[model samples]
Target: MAGLTVAALGVVGFLGYQAAATAPDHPTQARPGSHASQSKEKDKDRGRQKKKSTALPAASGTGERVVYALDDKRVWLVGADGKATRTFEVGPSPASPDPGTYAVTSRNEGGVGSDGVQVEHVVVFHSEGGVVFGFSAAVDGSMPDPNARKRTGAVRESRADGSALWEFAEVGTKVVVIP
Candidate 1:
């Protein structure tokens, strides 16, 4: 029994050392629901309680598709009637796509983002110049820092929003990026 216990301790110690050595120098904190509520409160306190407009950018083509505005950091799921069915704010990827129209090229149900966060509902649209732009949601419902630079090219959204986008955008669905 004593020898077995010693062997287990040795294995545990080695594993701990390996984990410590592999840890990142800087770890990110997940943005929680409370933080969002606080942000809303701050916006109200500053008298900026105006509702987010659902209007699509004028130059974005009228179609049944997803429209993303780089300047606004917002997305609109437009219906066949050329009206926005849903709109939500999102975090920009390390690299954004140039203003243009693209089609949903591929999709992965879930995966680890290059930044090491587990995300779901990945909807990819454009890939070129060493950057692939897509949409995903953190599995924990946490958000990465918008101001901090991320390693991957993913427009992070809330889980609910991500699911909506994943459902609305299928292979060959139109995607428009507007500056």
Candidate 2:
């Protein structure tokens, strides 16, 4: 009976270790230089490598362009080499723009949005159904909750991402929308 109990204890410990090893990505508590810690580091590197090797969908468009995925709620700034230079998440309004190619028709450094918030990095692309669609970030680094009853087509992004978009996109810059 004693021998059987010891064997069960060893099996339980090994199973617990195995479960931790195969767990999802999260901060690990392994001691430094331990095999567990080393494996965790390797796993993180693998994740980053995977992201680097994965290319944006071909329908995102060719050459330099801003690719917006409506379904994914993400945006990619594609460089001339047809690779994404910057990718970030965006919070699009309920009335999201249709999936189609567009051009940045105008821009404003700062302006008052329909939601009564002071916004910056205003890049207007299209207007439809009495709604003027554009991307903007509140000057105070806040997101806008536009009035649903009124015309609101603002696509809100993080302050840092909004700055990058403002600098890269200019008048006539191509904006591709993917479903």
Candidate 3:
């Protein structure tokens, strides 16, 4: 009878170990009366907040300006209060401009883009070695691929974004480029 009892305990111990080894690393079973639906809703809300958040680094100078993050391929139209009024993604050029503060020197309502696309909202800010750096948007709302051979430094954005930039960044508007 004692031998039988030991054998039964051994069997139970082996089964318990097997069960634990096969279990998932995370919790697989839900607790009774747990708020699973509420947890899912909270997770979705967190995702939306994550999407809305853009952690902007410190920008140079003061007052209203447009901040372009070269590494992130993002742009933020900062207001005079140093708050971002608008933000969007952009297609960077292979020829990166030197990180510094610049002013919009010129504007064109429409032009034939370097990639031969009909573009609008051309805002020129910097020119070096014959490559004029600026922001533009295609008329068809398409972004052009950065052509290393062309030596153009036009940062392409969406049509709507370009329109906003065109209206916001006038001649002499501050543009801060950051690495």
Candidate 4:
């Protein structure tokens, strides 16, 4: 009986030693160069690449003219001296029915109202010396609403010095000048 008890005690002691040995130590704080740190570094690198890829180029020019191009659309702006000052994107007014002529007007009065009323008027303005230089698309359905009469695509404007004024969407489309 004594021998049997000794054997049982030995087995229990071994099990206890194993359980204590395998118990996890107090959770240690993560050290630098750990897996988490490596992952963070990788994320930062990806962010840097994304920013570089999406950066816009600086504009370039020195004359008084400005030319803008977005996709297949283009526009040219010239100063009184025939110098280009600014080029921008613009779409046709809604009153035009031709598909090959681009036109713009200073009057904006027609559009689909929020209440579903078909308000009919031109919207959008490009002014030079108080003169409206409106632009239009040469196709039907190009300008659907007066309130949203700006070009419906990307727009990039550059000054005569090649400095970019703005790069955005639907610019120079809404809001017209009368005189």
Model 2: per-residue lDDT, tens digit, 1-179? 99999999999999998888777764467899999899988999977865653457777778999988876667889988898899887777757788899999999988897677788898988889977888888877666554466558888788788899999999999999888
Model 1 — which ten-residue stretch has the worst lDDT?
46-55
CA lDDT scores, all candidates in order: 0.84, 0.83, 0.85, 0.36
* TM-score attained by model 2: 0.67
Q: Per-residue lDDT for 1-179 in model 3, tens only?
A: 99999999999999998888667663355464578556766879987865654665665557899888887788889889988889998987768799999999999999987777899999999999988899999888777566667667879999899999999999999999998
Window of ten residues with lowest summed lDDT in model 4: 153-162
Backbone collisions counted per model: 0, 0, 0, 32
Whole-structure CA lDDT of model 3:
0.85
Q: Give the distance in Å from residue 90's predicted Cα in candidate 3 to where it truly belongs.
A: 0.3
Error of 1 at 86 (Å): 0.7
Q: Tell me, by lDDT, which candidate is best.
A: 3
- Model 4: how far residue 107 lies from native, Å: 2.3
Clash count (model 4, backbone only): 32
lDDT of 2: 0.83
Q: What is the lDDT of residue 110 in candidate 1?
A: 98
